[model samples]
Target: MTRTARSRALGSRPARSRTARQHAVGLAALLLLVAAAPASASATPSPASSPARHLEGTLPSGAAYMIDTPDHWNGTVLLFSHGYRPEGSPNPAVNAPDEPTKQLLLKEGYALVGSSYATTGWSVEQAVPDQLAALDAFTKEVGAARRTLAWGQSLGGLITTTIAERYPGRIDGSLSMCGLVHGGVANWNSTLDATFALRTLLAPGAGDADVRLTGFKDAADAAASAKRLGETLGTAQNSADGRARIALAAALHAIPGWNDPRTPRPAPDDYPAQQANQYTAVRGLVAQPGFAWRAEAERRAGGNMSWNTGVDYSAMLARSSQYKEVKALYKSAGLSLRDDLRALARAPRVSAEPRAVRYMADHAAPSGRLDKPQLTIHTTGDALVPVRTESAYRQAVAEAGRSPLLRQAYTENAGHCTFSPGEQLAAVHTIDHRLTSGSWGDTSPSALNSRAQQADPTTEARYTTFRPGPYPRPFRGQGLFG
Candidate 1:
């Protein structure tokens, strides 16, 4: 996502045939929306329970999407925009919300809508407008009032925040989860950190050695260093350094040789899991001379470089003033920052949907409001989004005197949506409270906590069983990235 011009984000799913009961539940929800509408309703959008309607269309860019509408939409609408996919693909409208979210929204009479935002090739600027357009189309067709709620996950989160800032009164509430708020700053910083790590792996005992790639004139020297780096990777992976090992594997996977240049990598292939295991396996054999077998294998196979990694890294590194001072970090990591920087500048600019960009551009502060209440949630330990981004944004908003309109929730020991039932229910309740009352509730334990503490194990098990599966369609070839 960082490498891609338009930043998108997140994971995958499993398939189970829909059940009769499920269909019944959906139908029931739809009927309620239609029946609940006010007879005298005029242009003002009001909440109603209607069966969700799916709409599809082509955007100006020729990008297409399928959007799902949860029926009986209370004019209070929720729109989710997905983050960037390295493949530059768009997401289906219903990308990230869980089953619980759908049920809760439907039962609450909230209309939930999502779309793939036309072409994935467009950046957030284009995608955000497309979403707005989609909403316009939906309003005309459904006759729902214009009062709305906008939200997105990762890249979608980025889009939502920008919209919230830009659109002001147009949006009632905004939620962005694990989005890249700092743009070039965050991307460049992370890349420098990665390069630094790589350098450390290469020069184990020589930790004091500078990571100057210029010193190495040819493939032989670079390959030798790469071999050393591989051994370090092996050691780290095998030494019970869980996070470090995961980080290394993730960085490697991000590079060209490890991943498929085409097509979004699905979640189920467990690419990260596989990469970790592969590193572990190779690490076990590093004591054997010529232990950098994998790195050597890659070189022998022509080491086809990925276009995104180096190019994006260079673009960010150049744009970021901080990266300039941190150049030594790369030098210590044994990488040629100068060469990569030049090469990336000359590379083509990646394209992305304009909707997200427009949303961000519109909502930027000094020009936006600070009166509406907003709640942001992000897993503290998220490797992908890097929790720092969330914290930084909150700080920025607070510093801007918008603290009254902003609040943040941190999920513990969770991945993207991998929260415990207590966490999920607590979040749902919080959102409901904010939407219904326009106020973040006073500090108090939630119903979910009480239930978790005293409820019967059988009931608890049943509730847990209903939890949404990880990445709804992981390998089904149906994601924004795919």
Candidate 2:
């Protein structure tokens, strides 16, 4: 999905106690690092005069990493993991989200590091290990970090969370921004639901030209099929039935209808406007070739990893938070929800290859067993990674009995990872405070907004209270795709 669509699709804080021994260890480590550096090197410099130590190297696994440590070492290393890059796209070599944030962090004396995974295109398996390897490289090439924080955006957010859970002792804290924390099964199935609805509702008999849920031969073919479906949906949007169907599809996945941050969210009774926004999101889904990632994911997994077999549209909708909106839209259009449900029931269902499903679970799903402090940030208006991901993750963490270990924040923007330098700094500082104090500080939206404003006046103005709807069809491991 485009950043706009991702922002539109989806949409916390506290304090605690600290252990003296742990605090002493962390402090001692920091002091040791500072003492080891040349005394003169500890002096901060102006942005124009700052000299950062830069290092770049390739890991044995073929992943490349870059590390930047400012002249004034802060003893904290921000190990950034980047988001997904389509298989054929160029990979980024740096870890920072934006130049402004990068400079701000460096100017504040924080070290930054990141890795371009061994392979691209949803390679979460490679990313997790590659990122760890990059950190190892950092320790050898530079020096031991007094504290390390795993941070990432989008797919990288998943990687960051995984690292925290899998290797808690390796890092002190983690920050995940706009991550797909709901796991690959939930993410792909959500997309599948939307695409299947579009095909069943509008282009049912298009045959070979229709978008393929699986079995794509290549990226070009996947893109072409997505384009075809998008074009069909575009024309279909002119009618009430088409628009209602689009809303139904989006709701099944709990996709939000606020893609543009500049515009206010549609009011509860504004069915027409809501559907219009949903159509744009749906259009962006297929038009931007959002579904193309499914093909790439399947290719990497060696087969299909998603399915709709045994899925009951009625049951699914009943569980969806978007059900009310779907019902309202259908009623306004004088459409029969039962009839649409029947149509969905009659459509041929897709099934997943068992191995592929396992591959996704192993690489893309979080265990939700938080062993260290972790914080997540998402824009309430992000359509690409959807706020539903945060909701699903919260459920998982609660289920694991580790709710207190995790906290979440939201930006009032409408684009994917559309955080300003101030917002980014606020989140980083929040994590840093938690690590040092061993308890969360004030993490309320108002508190965070205040901090962000103080850090940068240009910060986006929408950091108000909001909660994301439930993620429709959260992954439950083994039997999820059956």
Candidate 3:
């Protein structure tokens, strides 16, 4: 079972009232540190007298990163961390000290140091140290500020928050965008995803290795299954190596029988066949048969696949090995089919054995109670990192009576980093206000995600008339990003 983009889903806006205004003001006050940045530091030589040079290096663990220094830089510095991908050469496009943030900060007189943490297959324990080391190296090499600000997006956000918590005094403040704060289940929404992948692969539409391999136990039968797979996957959808996809599909099929080798559960109701068709179709189009999947398939065929080898290797050898291997792994991980699927929803948590968890918990505190100012901006219709996540954290902070330091801004239309110029400007304004005034005070409902708001007529009609179809131009009312 797979999900398609829902045609009708409403966006939720922040509660409108004077209190929202007060929250905005509070955020402004918290970030006021940036406003007074110039006054606190001593006068420095001009950047013209000195040109900032970019430096690159690798950590002891082989994680690579880079740092840059502006001429005659003041003490202020910012450390940049990217999400997911391994850090290598700096990509100035998205990296800070790149175009946008760099130009703004430089004009305002702040030194910037960008870094790439240890890349994929490496956890934050390795990454954070590499980042800190980069900062130290930048300071000594370029002669900049003793303290620095940490910033990241998505996975980068998680690392940024963890770094902020772990090195409180050493870090000035953290700027996290769409970061994952809640660990375990919240971080890994994959169990259901795995189930869906299995279902799609096994469905009657096309090549299904699981079914091909199931009946045959002998080597001849295994060879037959592989031959059948080669024939079925020759189509564009299943073509290329797609080893991970194959592994995921195989895991889904094998997991069910491992727990109840005899009994089988029915498919889920939510993933209607039409939705599944749409998902497979769209995904097939978007992730064409060449790059990531093809390479994965080639790697698997070569007996050298990375990124969750457990799932891949097991699937590749499913016909040869007994079911015991997968069963043992799942049982150890508490993912037996005998349990309710919802119970399996709790992902690999901190309590899960250390060997199984990916990233190390740098600072595992119950959410910290911060006295400093903080502003959180999120799109109500975020498809990638749902806005509900931010709301949960805000609610937790409120329940703990530590809401004083928090300011929240909700945009109706944006999703993840997707935002219209108007929405982006608003976000920039919010950040600017926080940095300048040390407080924020704006909390009026604004049309951001038009599609999302249109899902609810009452909300949509209140703002403006709703016309549905491909997004109409110069989009106005209830939507920000097209």
Identify the candidate with maximal TM-score: 2
Clashing residue pairs in all predictions, respectively, total 56, 16, 23
Winner on TM-score (1 vs 2): 2
Mind giving the per-residue lDDT tens digits that candidate 2 earns over 158-237? 98988988889889999999998998878887788888888888887655456776667887888888888878888889
Runs in model 1 deviating more than 4 A are: 1-52, 88-91, 182-184, 200-232, 235-371, 420-429, 443-482
**Which of the two, 1 or 3, has more lDDT?**
1
Rank by lDDT, highest first: 2, 1, 3
**Each prediction's whole-model lDDT (CA):** 0.46, 0.81, 0.41
Off by over 4 Å in 3: 1-51, 59-61, 69-75, 86-94, 97-101, 190-372, 379-382, 395-401, 410-416, 419-437, 441-482
Q: How well is each residue in 344-446 modelled by candidate 1, as lDDT tens digits?
A: 3453322212332232233321222445666666554344445555545655676677877776666433244344444433444555567778677652333
Report the C-alpha displacement of residue 373, candidate 3, in angstroms: 3.7
Worst 10 residues of 1 by lDDT: 473-482
Q: Estimate each model's TM-score.
A: 0.53, 0.85, 0.48
